[model samples]
Target: ILIGNLFTGNESMGNGGAIVVKSNSKPKIINNTIVNNHSLYGAGIWMSCSALNVVLQNNILWGNKASESGNQLYLRSTGSTYSIINNLLEGGVDSILFETPYSGILQDNYMFSPEFADYATGDLHLTCSSLAINAGSVPVVNMPLYDMDSNLRLNGSEYDLGAFEADAAATIVSQPQNMIVMNGDIATFTVVANGANVYQWEVSTDMASNWAAIVDDTIYSGATTSLLTVNSYAPMNGSLYRCIISGNCPQVTTISLPALLLVSNPDGFDENPIAVSVYPIPAYDFVNIIHAAGSRVIISDINGRIVADYAALSSDNEQISVSNLNNGVYFMKITSSNSTQIIRMIKD
Candidate 1:
């Protein structure tokens, strides 16, 4: 989050003031007032990657002109997955400076001017009758979803273009898709997310309390499948479990609702509908995850670095390897298409 504030006569301020982010990393720049700041090269923002994950939101990026290279704002992240959310990239030689941000979701925003007198005087407010009104996407992350300045985001149509709006009510959009699994086989859970990269999963022990993140799910990653060992252990009978998923796509963190499952708690009668069971809460070396069928398995270190990933697990009560691991905690995410079961391991 870098903002450029300078005192200059000409529009271009000679080099720098440009933003740079390399691949294999995720970053964001928001709500900045960059005017009169320029560079001979990439001034506004420059990114390069075939699969970049970033977001630009509700920023007044204009005036600070540049040329010879890069857009007044440019995009080197062509073919990458980035977003151009609600913002004002206007007045510059070219409004939006990008390469072809064709991946992430693009919504309502202004590429032209909302007519501001000057930044120092602070009259950048938008008029209700302005052309920038009601011209943006309904689902943006950080354009101030709520109109603290009495805009139209609270009670009105989908969304407004610029920073200020008429209504101020904001809502988050996340696709809560149900995952199904076979009674005895393993499965995987996948979601196509944009602007977000990290993910966390919460377990619901009590129905009343929305859902508490499983204590150690904060380091999880989004857009990937989680493994659940069928022959693993779970809570008690008649217990209800839900997976509350959330992550950082860009600036907007979306949670994938909850996928529920009921344990086969023997109501004093019989046991069915039960999936799998993993044993030894704190096993030293060998842990057994036995389900009616088979499942995939994954082993991630404390920092959420996947050290081991395997598919098409063996039959029920499969033999797991905890050798070559230090003495500490590790997360083993096991899944089948229907549900995901995360387990903790202790390697001595």
Candidate 2:
């Protein structure tokens, strides 16, 4: 029985990085963190046993690499009796080898990053932002009293999905920043928070007065995850977006600040004869503009307020520092002797 263990950085030339169950063993692997292991097959675990009553539950298998396939797990026995439940697998079904007409119970598995606190130094502790917090199977019989870190196994009503349990409090790591995109372009907003929580992104068209829950449709995607993407159009301009994150075990909830979306140049910009380039969209600190010398440049916010202006450009490459600007949308207009070009900018 392998329980409350950490299996990491192991390598194998043939089968498994951590464990290679043969044709006869019945192993119970529960509540473990198996990560960063590599092998030719099944970088985390490889089980080919035809034995009965093999159990695997409440474990995390992530960030493992395999040369052939099954980077997390490989199941070679098609008729083995097994039980797999409530594990965080990185690649979902694709993480396992093929076994048709399987004889096992697989339930409540997740296919996302477990979000370890410090993966580089091999500290696999659960961070406040880990989805593994309070994500395990409920009513687990004969479970361990404490996790691998010696913390209480059940920090909340339910056990966490990994070998470590996080604290109950939920905190936002980074709020979703505003986006600026051209008409027909895609705009995305992402939020980073600490905890295993439910996420629901909402939109407010009436300037943060009334909000409506967004759904997966032709207009938007990932309304339920921390990241949201929108198929932007002119009508989505000035729309406010926010995410509602909630967690259990005291029921902590957080509502993020509403960020505005700006769609620039709904009618599209006129083409200029001379080639002008503005690069690194969704810029964080600095944005570069390259064009002909002696071109005049002007930058304005969504409200048509001039933020930065240059009377005449002396060089081909001009760097504009957007470090002080608030996260949102802006427009840049560059004019040469004969032609003028306007481009949309997003301060991410």
Candidate 3:
């Protein structure tokens, strides 16, 4: 598939000043700009014999000249089929030269001026008032995600009928900041971006190389959203985190700088402490705290207000119901016979 490209400023002697499709090749040519070329036949493009199944959609063909015939395009093939839709042609639909038995679907093409931003300097970006805006067919199958300059495609209500999409820019508004938290504390990182974008959070233990994408599971969730939360911090939580924002119009993608995550042992907590596990960092309804039996658990919000207090009576695992709590950061204090541990939890 030849998608999202620009071809211009060429001259040819035989045929196809810019592009010539040979036999047995089925190329889908979409969202391209071809202009200012001269040739004997098919000044802009030519489909030779036996070139079967060609698709030309959302393209701009203009300012091409032919010595004798077929100023913009020439098709000479009996086995060829085409799908020509939502294109802006210079000399109208009559500019195409087709041999007998032409087989394909052709509709919704424009023949008027395309109103480029700057035609002299080859700036083919469409103007706001151009007729090509919102003139393309709906639901293009296998359409390219980005345009020629890596901007996003389909900026408006539908795809535009040219190489460049309408006015759309993807940019990051607020980057994720560095964070430091105590062991077993809940740490959250967030990024804010504008435009139609997709978010992906990644973590790197070795300073930016060998990054791994975070996934939604029992331990970690919201890996694809703007917010990422680490439910319980351990020694391994002292890594770098970053977010990638992409899927803008004209197809541009960008990544934010890695932010540091420093996980420290709790105050006065000894090394090699009791093993405790917490699950579902951004807890929606409940949070599970697994520890030794007979351990006392105290939950407090950011303001040191005690919310829940319980003791592990019969088993080492306890499920604390937090469905009534608002969304914020909370702390948990677990005290055993020989040790005490403080954990951070997030209620969503």
Top TM-score model? 3
**Considering every candidate listed, which one attains the maximal lDDT?**
2
The deviation in Å at residue 243 for candidate 1 is 43
lDDT of 2 at 284: 94
**Residue 185 CA displacement from its true place in model 3, Å:** 39
Measured over all alpha carbons after superposition, the RMSD of each candidate to the real structure, in angstroms, is 15.3, 19.4, 13.9
* TM match of model 1 to true structure: 0.34
**Model 1, span 1-348: residue lDDT tens:** 332122222333443345656665565655444444566644665566565657765555555556656534666664577766766666443555555545675654566765553556655554444444444444434444345454334233344443444322222343433333433333233334433334445444332244454432322233232321222123322112223222321222334534333333223423343456766756666777787245678776544567777696777768676766777756676766555565556666
Q: Any idea how many clashes model 3 has?
A: 11
lDDT (tens digit, per residue) of candidate 2 on 169-190: 3567898887878879999999
Better of 1 and 3 by lDDT: 3
Can you give the lDDT of residue 277 in candidate 2? 88
Candidate 1 weakest ten by summed lDDT: 223-232
Worst 10 residues of 3 by lDDT: 245-254
lDDT of 3 by residue, 1-348 (tens): 777777889989898988988878888888788888889999988887566557888888999898988888888876878888888899888999885567888787779999988999988888766778767775345876888777668665567776788765446788787786777778888888787367889887643446899998865677988899886566544366778676433333457656667666644445556687877898999877787578888776644577888866346777778998888876666777756655667888
Residue pairs in candidate 2 whose N, alpha carbon or C atoms collide under 3 angstroms: 128-194, 128-195, 129-194, 129-195
Model 3, residue 33: what's the lDDT? 84
